[model samples]
Target: MTTQQLHEQILLKKSFLCVGLDVDLTKIPEHLLETEDPIFEFNKVIIDATHDLAIAYKPNTAFYEAYGIKGWLSLQKTINYINEKYPDIFTIADAKRGDIGNTSSMYAKAFFEDLKFDSVTVAPYMGKDSVEPFLAFENKHTIMLALTSNEGAFDFQTLITNGTELYKQVLETSKTWKNSENLMYVVGATKAEYFTEIRKIVPDSFLLVPGVGAQGGSLSEVCKYGMNNKIGLLINSSRAIIYASKGTDFAEKAREEALKMQQEMEEIMSLKFKV
Candidate 1:
């Protein structure tokens, strides 16, 4: 999806919520295991239940990769289901992949072509060459890591080099890459205060923010400094929503959780943009 399309969805839904489909077999309802593909079944129900409450869905690739081939198949099926059933809903392969040039290109093709995700998260440690390949795909976004919500982010992302922080350097340097307009970013909601500085560097780029509910990051704090004129923020809530209840009513509970966030987002937009 193009940036305009994403903005339109946020406006139409009155939400920029991205539901993280970080499914784990052990945490899912026990009854789902009896089905042919428990992962896909679990995902299908969650998608059906909460698709309207969310504008995007991000399936972290690690969850699928852990189960090997069957997991990968489930991932494919999940993306296919979303594309076929809700084409307007933005999909993200939260793979956090970055490698050498040729390897990165193949990863790009795998997620962008084979799986057909509208966006994929990427680590920027390897620098521009590792990221440009993913940005090459038209209308497909490369969401580069910047100021993550994790405690370990302080280890490298904040290190100053020649008077500029490492994460800021990554944000500024990435703008010089090929097809940089297609670039978005991953800014953890835990570092909500940093959004003020981050926006100064990439004022218009979209940010895929995690670390909300389960991580205790406040949505109001994030939007206070992170929101832009177009409302460029995709705040994700994974465990808190998807695992709201591991019982048979898991999907319903997930919808309830998502609805709470969506309602909050609608109110935020109504006040911020007066829409």
Candidate 2:
């Protein structure tokens, strides 16, 4: 989806929520395991239940990779279901993949062409050559890791270099790459205070924000500094919503959780945009 289409969805839905389909088999409902493909079964129900409450769905690739071939198949089916059933909603392959130039190109193909995800997360450690390949795909966004929500983020992302934080440098240097307009970024909600500074560098760019809910990132705080004129944020909530229950009512419970976030987001937008 193009950036404008995504923003339109945000307005139509009155939400900037991105439900993270980071399914963990161990954490899912026990009854789902009896199904042929537990992962996909779980995902389908969640998608159906909360698709309207969210503007995007992000399936972290690690969850599928853990189960091997069957998991990969489940991943494929999930993306296909989303594309065919809800083409308007954005899909993200939360595969933080980055490698050498050639390898990155293939990785991009796997997610952008074969799987048909609208966007894929990528690491920027390898620099422009590794990321520009993914950005080459038209209308497909390359969400580069900027400031993350993890405890270890300070190890490298915040390290001062040339009198600036490494992540700021990454954001500055990334703009110089070809097709850089297609680039989005991953800014963890835990670092809400950093959004003010981040916006200074990439004020118009979209940010895929994780670390809310289960990770304890304050939604209101993130929005206070992170939101732009277009409401440029995709706040992701994973375990908290998907694992709301491990019973037959899992999907229903998931919707309840997502609705809570969506309602919160709607209120934020109304107060911020005066809609």
Candidate 3:
């Protein structure tokens, strides 16, 4: 999806909420395991229940990759279901993949072409050569990791080099890459204070923010600084939303959780844009 299309969806839905489909088999409803593909079944129900409440759905690749071939098949089915049923809903492959140039190109093709995800997360530690390959795809976004929500982020992302922080350097340097306009970023909600400085560097770029809800990143605090003229924030809530309940009413509970976030987003957008 193009950036304009994404912005339009936010307006139409009155939401910028991205439901993270980071499914865990053990945490899912026990009854779902009896189905042919428990993971896909679980995802289908969640998507059906909350698709309207959310503008995007992100399935972290690690969840699928853990189960090997069956898991991958389930992931493909989930994406296909979303594309076929809700084409306007932006899809993100939350695969923080980055490698050598050639390998990165293949990873891009896998998520962008074969799986048909609208965006994919990438780690910037490998630098421009590794990430630019993903950005080469037209109308697709490459969300580079910036200041993350994890405590370990302090180790490298905040380290100053030549009077500029490492994460800031990544943002600045990435702007010069080919097709840089297609680049977005991953700014963890836990580091909401950094958004002020981050926006100074890439004010217009979209940010896929994780670490809300279960991670305890304040939604209101994130919006206070992270939002832009276009409301360029996809705040994700994984465990808190998806695992709201592990019973037969899991999908309903998930919808309830997502609705709460979406409602908050609508209010925030109203105030930010004065809609």
Candidate 4:
């Protein structure tokens, strides 16, 4: 999806919530394990339950990759289902994939062409050459990991070089790449203090923010500094929503949790944009 398509969806839904589909067999309802593909079964209900309450759905690749081929198949089924059923809702493959240029191109093909995800999270540790391969695709996005929500983020991302934090340099340097306009970023909501400065560099680019509910990132602080004129924020909530009640009623409760976040986001956008 193009950036304008994303912005329009957020406006139409009155939401910027991106429900994270980090499906784990251990965490899903016991009832779903009886299905042919437990992971896909779990994801289908989650998508059907929360699609209207959210503008995006992000499937973190690790959860599926851990299960091997079965998991990989499940992940493909989940993305395919969304593409056919909810094309307006943006989808992100939270693969965090980055490697040498040639390998990066393959990873790009796996997610963008074969699986057909709207965006895929790419780690920038390998630098611009590693990432540019993913950016070469048309209308697809390379959501680079910037300031993350993890405790270890300070180890490298915050380190200053040439009088700028490593991540700040990433935001500045990446914009110069070919087709860089297709780039978006992953800014952890837990690092809300940095949003004000981060916005200074890429003010209009959509930020795929993870670390809201289960991670305790304040939604209000994220919107206070994270939102732009187009409401460029996709605050992701994974465990808190998907695992709300691991029972037969799990899907309904997922909607309830997503609705709460979406309602909060709607109110914040109203305050920020004064609709």
Predicted structure 4: lDDT: 0.93
Clashes of each: 0, 0, 0, 0
**How does residue 176 of candidate 1 score in lDDT?**
97
Ranking by lDDT: 2, 1, 3, 4
Which scores greater on lDDT, model 1 or model 4? 1
For all candidates in order, the CA lDDT equals 0.95, 0.96, 0.94, 0.93
lDDT, candidate 3, 1-275, per-residue tens? 89999999999999999999998999999999999999999999999999999999999999999999999999999999999999999999999999999999999999999999999999998888999899899999999999999999999999999799999999999999999999999999999899999999999999999999888899999999989999999999899998999999998999999999999998998887877
The C-alpha stretches of model 1 lying farther than 4 A from their native spots are: none
Assess candidate 3 and give its TM-score to the true structure. Answer: 0.99
lDDT of 4 by residue, 1-275 (tens): 88898899898888999989999889999999999999999999999999998989999999999999999999999999999999998999999999999999999999999999999999988888899999999999999999999999999999999899999999999999988998999999999999999999999899999999889899999999888898888899999999999889999999999999888988987877765
Kindly provide the TM-score of model 2 when superposed on the true structure, using C-alpha atoms.
Answer: 0.99
lDDT of 2 by residue, 64-119 (tens): 99999999999999999999999999999999999999999999999999999999
Error of 1 at 196 (Å): 0.3
In angstroms, give how far residue 19 of model 1 lies from its true place.
0.5
Instruction: Tell me the spans in candidate 2 whose CA falls farther than 4 Å from its real position.
Output: none
Per-residue error (Å), model 3, residue 242: 0.6
lDDT of 1 by residue, 64-168 (tens): 999999999999999999999999999999999999999999999999999999999999989889999999999999999988989999999999997999999
In model 1, the Cα lDDT at residue 2 comes to 97
Model 3 lDDT at residue 261: 94
Q: What is the TM-score of candidate 1?
A: 0.99
